[model samples]
Target: TGVSKGAMLSHKNVVSNVLQASGAYSPTLDDGAEFVVTALPLYHIFALTVNCLLFLHKGSKNLLITNPRDIPAFVGELRKYPFTVLTG
Candidate 1:
């Protein structure tokens, strides 16, 4: 409901869910891959946790987006690499 660490905490929860979920719809993180988060790193939790921690565990690169709100800019940033995963 606010802009702070709570957002990061929530993102952490999402990462945990993805990692722990046994559902068939879930996709587990690969041992090695690159993840690019298009969501604002400072605006929400997904980038904070998943891009930071989970990728770290898998020895993946986390492309942190400082400003994800700008659509064109985001696309431009995305075109720079072949990202294995993009977390919103």
Candidate 2:
């Protein structure tokens, strides 16, 4: 894959992407058992797709952090979850 600015995506594209991406990772994924620490704000595309939708489709437990600036709170949140996957 090459790098470029993000493209605009439709809801269907997103759903398809999540399904395909998760399928690519299925061999390593433990359906409904992964705990994900999603530090990124869901407003962003990468987080919205890979962090939120992808994991959600996998039935993962997500810890959404609206603010990642507060170091103390972020660390505290991290401590609370036995996260197997993280976005940062």
Query: Clashing residue pairs in candidate 2, if any?
Result: none
Provide the overall lDDT of each model, using Cα atoms, as 2-decimal numbers: 0.61, 0.88
Model 2 quality (TM-score) = 0.84
lDDT of 1 by residue, 1-88 (tens): 6864432346556666656532422365566655645465543455544566556656777677777778798889888878877765
TM-score of each: 0.59, 0.84
lDDT of 1: 0.61
lDDT of 2 by residue, 5-81 (tens): 77778889999989888989999989999999888879788898888999989999999887789989999998887
Candidate 2: minimum summed lDDT over ten consecutive residues — where?
1-10
